[model samples]
Target: MRIRQRCGERARKRADRGPSGLSLLPWLLMGLGALSHLLGGQAPNPWIGAAGLLAFNTVYIAIVFRAFDRSRRESPLTWGLLVTLGLLTFGLAIGYGREWLLLFPLLGLGVGAVVRRGRLLPLIAFPLVVAVGAVTFWRDGWGSIGIVYGTFISIMVTAAILALDETVRELRETREELARAAVEKERLRFSRDLHDLLGHTLSVIVVKSEVVRRLAPRDLDAALAQVADIESVGRQALTEIREAVTGYREGSLATELDRARDALSTAGIEPVVRRSGPLLAPQTEALLSWVVRESATNAVRHSGASRCEIALSGSADRVRLTVTDDGRGPADGTPGSGLRGLRERVAAAGGTLDSGPAPRGGFRVTAELPVEASVPPEGDPAR
Candidate 1:
């Protein structure tokens, strides 16, 4: 929410200022000398001069006012108006020759506001420079060199400033977009982690709780041992929930196998674990551990099986894990959210996850992963 507010405030600030017709309006004062010349009525046909002055102001106003809006600035109509402004500028300068020549700089301002690309700029700028140089030199001699230089400088400077302002605004908007995406991604990760953690942990707790209930009458000491196991599971659940919330939990393959063995035994299912090949990287183990945890929990909670097998094997660059159980199989013949989440994780690590009824009348889950999985950084809390 704070991020959204900050983004709104920045957008408002960007909107409130920058390249606008009103900013260019102050430069209209530059033409006041021409206005003064006309008002004084010192030279040439007064009515024609007045008409040219009025036309220049109108076109200049039209070009500048529309230049601040992106759609209007890039329109064919704006270019046509700009061309008319150019023709009027040259007409006034060539016709009046003295005070009227000041419109060249105003034309430069309008051109700078609209023309953004360097490639296209020369197409317009070069001809204007040439025309202004030829006319100013013809009318005012070498002393008017200042007018030509000022016109070019005005175009380049204004273009650079407005272009830079546009760039800054784009960068700010891009940054806000990235920040929002990151926040959303983190929220998704947290939700998935919480689900995976609580699902497996609670299943084990419930299984052990039932074991305590059954053993309490027959053997008090055995019931107390199961109660102690429940206490240990609860403590571990608290730690895992903390890690999940903080996004810093890492899992170990050996530790998960131990938990899976205990969990399956508590649920009265025999667990058989097999492993081969070299020791794997922690990242690869962490992902494989999630597979083991999810599969074992499903076996306990849903699969009414007497035996479950978890087999892990790896080569130089790849690893595989297969968990199978002699059970009735998924009632819907499809995986639950836990398996779906596991598929997303494995796929992100450049791996594959498959779950279905095995050919031999039981449920099976097979996961194949690269030896060094491309997992985002999060590891076992103990590590």
Candidate 2:
């Protein structure tokens, strides 16, 4: 059973890989009749006949082997060799009609291997077929269709199969490329989600834990409230991380703003939020929530701000969110991964994200979105 299965696997692989040079080599057996006549010593000019037979075999092997390589098959030298082989076939077939005429089909195999699908194919095939038919009729005195028909079939079938194999190889390559691109895209999404979820959640826990320590020395009830808030934040972080992993997470701006207020207040920065104008699409809300999460996290983590403000203004066509802090200004270097990921998310929704040092003092991050930002289909990461 094992031996049979392995044989079947090998056969499948060969079918996929298309024809090799060795596959055509077996057809050379057709020349055996001429070889027998030469060996038996019945024909005239026997020395020259042996040499001509040797030359024919050598040329045929070279043409068929080179045909398997695309560059060699299309070379000018291959065409030159093919033309030379055609002349040999005509000379032998016309000179010695009986067994040597089999060389015409061998010549047809050579022509099939060299010519690709184009005007050149029919141009070469038409005259070759017509000439072989005429020569066979003149010499064999009629009822000689077998050799002519074999030549035509050899040329056409070989070309058609090789053409199909080329197309199959190209389609296989294109599918592999698409699969790789999708894997990379999903990797980017998972990394961005983990960063946003952990970054803000950890910062909030740190700030409120400090507040609990300080207030415990003065007020028991207040300190316990802070600890309870810590538990709630931790549980919410767990749920959000689960959704992010499965690529089904959705965001609400109102929920994010409430969390931002608590995060900023616990960090000892006053939080002032203002909003006005039309309801937004789910995708637009999702993008704005990321902006708020990233901005509030940055204010708590980097800025020495005493107060931070988040503002949202919307019209029929567009909605914009801006976060500003009265603190030390944007961090000195390049934007971190959070800001970069948020920028990509916003841009994918037909929007923009910008962060820089505020003109008045501190830092500001701004995001704008089209009101009609379409929700990604279920289970797909937003764009």
Q: Give the per-residue Cα lDDT of candidate 1 at 368.
A: 95
Q: Per the 3 Å backbone cut-off, how many clashing residue pairs does candidate 1 have? A: 3
- Native-structure RMSD, model 2: 3.4
**What is the per-residue lDDT of model 2 for residues 1-383, given as tens digits with 9 covering 90 to 100?**
99999999999887667777787888888898888887887667778778887888888889988998889988988888898898888877777677887888889888887784678889988888999999988877566688889898888877777767777877877887888877887787888888889999999999999999999999999999999999999999999999998888888889999999989989999999999879998778887888899999999999989999999998999998999998875567467888987887777777888988888988889988889775333212332
Tens-digit lDDT string for candidate 1 (1-383)? 99999999999986746657888888888888788887887748878888988988998999888987889999999999999989988988888787877888999998998996578887878788888999999998887788898889778777778888888778888999989987877776777777778899899989988888899999999999988998999999999888778777788899999999999999999999999977888888888888899899999999999999999998999999999999977789899988987888888788999999999978999999899887853222222
- Compute the lDDT for candidate 1: 0.86
Highest lDDT, which number?
1
List the global CA lDDT of all models. 0.86, 0.85
Ten-residue region with minimum lDDT total, candidate 2: 374-383
Residue 348 CA error for candidate 2 (Å)? 2.9
Error of 1 at 274 (Å): 0.4
Residue-level lDDT for 85 in candidate 1: 89
Clashes of each: 3, 0
